[model samples]
Target chain A: MRDRPATEARILEAAQAILIAAGPGGFGVNAVAREAGVDKQLIYRYYGGLDGLLEALGVRLAQWWQEKLMAGLPQTPVENYGELIELLALQLLHIVRSEPLALQSLLWELTGSESFVKSLSASRARAYGAWMAGVRGGLEPPEDVDAPAINALLIAAISQIALAGRQADTIIGLPTNDPATWDRLEKSLLRLVRGVYARP
Target chain B: MRDRPATEARILEAAQAILIAAGPGGFGVNAVAREAGVDKQLIYRYYGGLDGLLEALGVRLAQWWQEKLMAGLPQTPVENYGELIELLALQLLHIVRSEPLALQSLLWELTGSESFVKSLSASRARAYGAWMAGVRGGLEPPEDVDAPAINALLIAAISQIALAGRQADTIIGLPTNDPATWDRLEKSLLRLVRGVYARP
Candidate 1:
């Protein structure tokens, strides 16, 4: 019945809250059921248990990223190509910063059991790669820029930003969340993009 | 006597093993003593207790980073310029790839009860700033390069590379630890350095 789907969603929502609160512990069917305000049996029937619920949550997160990244893709070739690259960087940074849960889920995936990796397609990976490729394509290059290596470096740089968390300004002696910081990041990223595709 | 120092080191070593094996929960003093093959009271006597030991560990880790980063200061404007930047990036990536415990410790510091941020000092910040300024001074910029922004971007990018972990390669669609990856990273970095500071 319709109640079954509703019950499943409620359980997942409760599970996320619990996961965030407890942090690698405190994930239990009883706790989730209580938080969801549903019968424990209903959770079991809906999600097949805790593992099923977590698997579902992971899939949901991946889909969320896909949609978010695809929001402002370039539809044409002549619209300030550099702006497109900056927009994507800003959008990605905004999503990761605003939704701490997204980063948390990614961290969970990194430390997740092998079964979790097996079940999920590397959708997040693909999306990030495509984005990088787009940035490379948009570059206004000079001779001697190495495209492939720049792509690798950009990937490495972005990964570091994602993992360093938003508080890097405090940790690394920089200002946190300043417009200047984003401006610096975007300009540097463009240079990489341009550097990669510049004619040798 | 030297026995005291050995006992302290043994306690710290044991703490590391226990934390790795059992996660943070396994860090009880008694457990650490058992793992270290020392008396539990000795742990209290030397490090004062669990919290104290972790504090010491943090200081040791920070000291290690300071030494490693300062290992290769560029001696001349020409010699120290681009290579210094590459060396910093390489060292950062190596640490993030190999010693994940450092990241774990940093993550804990953010959420930790002990307030690690308080440990950051103005003098230390100035020292770091001075070193960065020195690195930048070696560069001679092209007419169009945004030198200050480029310097800031490189520092942020390097930190981000360290944070991204396995996701770096996944984002870039390459293997994480390949020599080819580092080569690409170096090239991209060199391009950024050159783009920002190369004389026209």
Candidate 2:
């Protein structure tokens, strides 16, 4: 119990590494303990078990993701939603590339666990709802905007980009610090968002 | 040998099943032979080794994927790229959902093998080059729509949506045939495309 706080952080870090290397199915207690250089019993005592560890990690990752997503957006609101989307896409690519392991772990759990999947959907719904509230600069989506639909689309699109960024990293064996492909991705996303948000 | 064709087909089928169940690393000669209900020795007689099997599978699967992707496009090109994008999104969602096993295998190899990744990049370049040739239907892009840039965006956006669709199937345990989600996605994508293709 004395080492509980540090143990939690260590377990999360170790879990992220295990997930990055072997995905969700490979997240074993022994592996995590060994990776963390901690006692197995300490992991059990600190996080309760694998499920608890995953739950904590999921919550942590979601908050981090939302914060990173919201970081590039202006505090108030903008008339052009495309601008926001473009920023969001670049920010998303940046964040995922920065923290590939955590994002990959979340994605793996999204595929591997039903409970985790539900949690992810709920969390996403909440985040998008919040984002939409801010999208029109406090006012709801304009009549022609189809706010809910737009929100869903943006969430889906950005989520895909973030995931694809991870896949791109794996494919080209690029380091997180490299911004070459990211520059290309950012340009493309800007065009796509402009397509969605620019006036007809 | 006399059963070369049969042996090759069996190997391909086995690789697909393994990809669906355990991904690329789990695909071994022993597993493939077992799954195909054939002698292990036959794998060597026909394919020479595991790498051969992977190469043969890659060629076969890539060809199959290309055919499947081209199956549902409008017979003739439409002036409004937005409508075409919607159609393409729906078609892609259908393809990704229905062919999860194949997609999984293709993605696994695309990221895992260096030579395969190079070929995949070349294939993508060709597809993008072709798409850019048709970027101008009636509307003009706000900025110069370079082939690489447009391709990167279009490919990223489409890939993201497809990945979402797959997750809805494999992770969220949602019905892959749910037209409502696809319909919503199509509208959003169409709007995005329109926003991009609109006159500056």
Candidate 3:
């Protein structure tokens, strides 16, 4: 009774851990109780139901996106547009590559048409957009730059490569599993960024 | 008795149709027999089994890629690198958006780990690389431009949008279902091209 907040926090953290590890499919009250070391009845009492637990988790995930995604980055505004993109893009690539939640959420977003997933997608979209904007800071490209489109393209490319590479080592013989390939990709990306985005 | 060539052609065509429409999951000897309007035994007798038929269909698909993917494009090389990429990216968008086969093949390639799909992926990769090279013709980007990376990014972006747009009306509030969004993407892509790739 005295540690209600601590208990709830433990439950939510466990829930998030499962969600990241196995995605939506593996989410279950039984698993949560087991992982959180709480009785199943406790979950029912604290959250009212499985849906309630899920909803709260969604909110928590959103807040975490802001905190974790924002903290410890180079916050100084980058005047060099190309370098800014490279920095932001590399950050995105690192997260997507290492974070199972991002990939799982993406898969769940695309596959599920349910209202729950839709709402989740909407919130994620907002969070992601905000994250991008926050990371970008005061960096502004020249008048001729199409920042939005370029950003979308870079995100799409990085995401697809990461997603597709999960099933195989190579996407179109690119050997995506190799770090050297990423280096090549980075080298090329930097070159293009330098070429297109004006140097400050 | 006299139409062995035609009957074989019909069966192969039906197989391709099924592969495109239903992907690998719907592929069945019985389905092919029914679609081709021939006895199931004929498929076994002619192709020597389903594997043979699949192999033949793979060959036919490769040939069709050469014939159809290459036909009627502006073969004339554009010295302007930006315009060249825009042209190719648009074509990829068009095909992926319109052709169920391309989408199906992509799905099949990613999801299936069997030898058959791997072979199909390999052949398709060869054909795609060839088509890209053939399309570029004599055009060349400046030494500063990272053409390969840019090309990979462009293809990834176009493909991801088209693929994800299959399930939902929008991707991260992009309104991908609308044609105008594509236009905006195009406008931005061209701008990036101009910014990066030098003029003729």
Best by lDDT: 3
C-alpha positional error of residue B40 in candidate 2 after TM-score superposition, expressed in Å? 3.9
lDDT of 1 at B128: 48
List DockQ for all candidates.
0.33, 0.33, 0.34
Q: Distance (Å) between predicted and true CA of B113, model 3?
A: 3.2
lDDT of 1 by residue, A19-120 (tens): 666543456788888888888887667777767777777677667777777765656553443355445656666676567666565455444444554334
Instruction: Write the residue-wise lDDT of candidate 3 on B1-200 in tens digits.
Output: 55999999899989988987666667889999999999989999999998888778767766665565565365676666577676766777777778877766665555455556666756765765777677676667777665666677667677777666766666657776778878877776665566666665
lDDT of 2 by residue, B50-166 (tens): 777767766666666556656665667666544555455566656665776645744563335345544553454344334434443673334555434444454445554555555
True contacts kept of 1: 0.26
Which window of 10 residues has the lowest lDDT sum in candidate 2 chain A?
A: A168-177
- TM-score of every candidate: 0.74, 0.76, 0.73
| lDDT, model 3, position B189 | 63
Q: Best to worst by lDDT, what's the order?
A: 3, 2, 1
| Residue B176 CA displacement from its true place in model 2, Å | 7.7
Q: Report clash pairs, candidate 1.
A: A147-A196, A160-B160, A160-B161, A161-B160
The docking quality of candidate 3, as DockQ, is 0.34
lDDT of 2 at B123: 50
